[model samples]
Target chain A: MAVNELGDHLRQGHPLPCGRLVEDVFDDLDRGRIDDHGRTCVHCATARRSLTTLMEATRALVDDPAEPPPNLLDRIMQAVRAEGRRGEALPLVPIDDTGAAVVPDLGPVDISRQAVAAVVRYAADTVDGVRARSCRVTVDDADVGALRIEMTLSLRYGAGPANELVETVRARIGSALHGQVGVRAGAVDLEIVDVWPEEGP
Target chain B: MTTPDLDHIGGHPGDGPGDDRLVTQIRVAEVAAAAARSTPGVAHLQQGLWGLVQQLGAEAWTRVTGRPRPDTAGTEVAVRVDPVTGAVTVTVDVMLVVDGRRPAAVVAGDVQRRIGGAVYAAFGVAPGRVSVHITDVAVPG
Candidate 1:
């Protein structure tokens, strides 16, 4: 405790890892001087290197930093925000008594809901004249691994969800889910939002 | 970045005397993250909906700057070390983006297996649960 107090006493605002203020280090760097402590401390060395890099970057930015492409700028910020949005966990195997799909020193596997949805979406996209919009693969409350897939899609402008077409899509989605994920889907509910006219003249 | 929460203070089912080897969350996460990142058909870690947007920009940057993007995988690992015995158990989570060349579900399974295998190989203990999330399906144009 006494040592901490002593270090704090010597510290400037917001001490670095070595109990020395980086601002002091910055000052020393500005004047092209490093004290005995700076010469010996690794943290100070790192800070000095960082300060040097920052100075270089600042000069570079001020000198020539120009406007980033508008589209690219928008995409970067969107990625920053959307990266954290993920779906719920869907167990790949049966959950035991503890509600964890594990075998005490063995295997326990789970995949995200979005992964299953992606499987459904990719499958739906394979159907002719169909564009998949979104999907949700929810676990059945009564069954361990059973899933119900709810999907939305837009049919081609001139096309319709004919009985034959719907059956084909259902079969395709079921096969994709079973083959890709190795789990049987309980129900595949396809809801066509509307007709898309992308291919129209 | 969520991992299984286990009581490490004491009385954990896995905790007992004579277990001396220590394993940390950081180490498991490192190993698991490496394995997941190396798997094929992973454009990068998950960034939901049209990850193609971000991938396009990143690819352009790499093309211009000649520096590959660093640290793409975000593996969440939680470790519980028994205070008394130093025994450890872990749970690892990873989210990835499918590059549209391979099936997402298959890739996800492979990720889970790889992380679980890598952690066990590194620490001689398996993760309690290895959760894989897929945020984007970047179908190639």
Candidate 2:
């Protein structure tokens, strides 16, 4: 029988390993042998083309060489050192466990403070004229998930009025924390440790 | 209905239907957390009040022991998976240092989109819901 005929037979009655076979055909580790049927079948041919495109895109990304910003490593290391100073073993708060019905072997659902800090840092870094030197976050043990945040910032002189800057920071922080983490920031304290001169206009 | 044979699927194990493979909640959370951190307008992730206490304690401990601080701390991630549909939901609380030039809402939306895309790419499962809580924002120098 022709390859197309064989593919038709597989589709009609024989099990042709739908998604799995397509994946195996592309995987480097286990490039499953595809008979002539796979080469001729329309569905498999389309899937193969897609997989090829994906692989090419991935290869291009791997080959790209992008330079990182100055002091990026130093800043990252500083953050790491700060975390070490803070210690490990982040606390995890449990969420609902009703998922046990669907997944018989489900584990506890919990969020960690370390994760929260990372998000805070990212949000703070985006503000203009504000460079986050360090951040300390606290979650209230109360029934309400209230947050107390303290950030040390290096500000640029003449970025904006100090009061305006503070207000903008407060609003952005409140919105980001609530939107991303589903937590409320009860209070945010910003300390300006240093002011740097601005660059060219 | 005929069950799909999962063993033939490539990539991670539990990614297929009816395969004894399992994706841990922590792993999913990490993916979400990484996505959030990568979003623009974010400064750093903060550990809440308890985190503050821990830092103070660490300071005291460092003063006494004179040992170097460890870099083990980062953002936290929490994941919830639906048993029926296998959908995942993620909630993240973050502190941002936004550009004084951009609107806060715009940055927040970007973070949300990035997190959703990252989760889908990593797990082949689109996040059912992604919630972001902004705790603080600052102007970057």
Candidate 3:
């Protein structure tokens, strides 16, 4: 039965050894398990190598104590507040022409496409090394209240790696919209419009 | 609950009796833009690349036709009025100079507050919505 299971595993990629077996092999808790897999299967060998690489990368990250940019916290807080204000101030336009229309006493809450765009633009601009050029925030007509935010940004040259900067902007905008504006960003699309030239030394 | 009287408040003077003059949407936008521009820490308003293109196009048209450009063509203010309630909403996009000292959020808030006040003062109706966008931060000299 064990041989048949191994054959099935090799053929169908079904039910490989339990995670415990992989952990045991890596931790050296069961040398016999490693020997069992090391002798015949190439899949286990590949898994072991991949796991080892992941562990090394995690350790390297843990060992690095590089401090975040000093303005990160301020930028994030400002962005949250700015975006929140935009969300709260969305205008309530009258949909119908009823003379006796009862304007809900919601006390000045407004929402519009431009308001959403402003919120997204402000949030993206708050990221260090990122300058938002234009932002277009659209609502999904089919799925009412769903938001799609698109932004064009000019990243500061030499501020940081481009990928890291983009990731930070994405994470910040998502979190700000969720936490501050009480809206789930369905899609956040970023375009690098330009790379700002660094000042002369 | 009592509804506030919207007509009794100040409005534009129309041609005939019982006809209330509606405030032009451009006027509302202009008020908001002036308010924002006057706020401290707001260095200057950015026309943006698109605005620049429009301006150049307008200039070319004017030069060829020898006609003055329309006032509404290049205005930065965008205003929308509710057809039923006559409520005005304004949106302004601006760039501020932070000088690395004050927070951008605070400057933006101040601008928003000032814009609301200006619109209210001009039209006697609270703006239904005021949206401010901070596009760029200028370094202080």
Task: Give the number of the best model, judged by DockQ.
Answer: 1
Worst 10 residues of 3 chain B by lDDT: B15-24
Better of 2 and 3 by lDDT: 3
- Pick by TM-score: which candidate is best? 1
* TM-score of candidate 1 to 2 decimals: 0.52
User: What DockQ results for candidate 3?
Assistant: 0.01
Cand. 2 Cα-lDDT: 0.50
* Candidate 1 CAPRI-style tier: incorrect
Count of backbone clashes, every candidate in sequence: 0, 80, 4
Better of 1 and 3 by lDDT: 1
Q: Give the chain A TM-score for each candidate.
A: 0.50, 0.47, 0.43
DockQ of model 1 vs. true complex: 0.12
Q: What is the C-alpha RMSD of each candidate to the true structure, in Å?
A: 12.5, 18.8, 29.5
Q: Give per-residue lDDT, candidate 2, residue B72.
A: 15
Q: Per-prediction DockQ, in order? A: 0.12, 0.03, 0.01
TM-scores, one per candidate: 0.52, 0.33, 0.33
Clash pairs for candidate 3: A90-A110, A90-A111, A91-A110, A91-A111
Q: What local lDDT score does residue A31 receive in model 3, on the 0 to 100 scale?
A: 49
Tens-digit lDDT string for candidate 1 (B1-141): 222223222122342321111123435666887888887766776433234343564455454445453333356566654545545567776766667565455566667777778877766777777776665556434
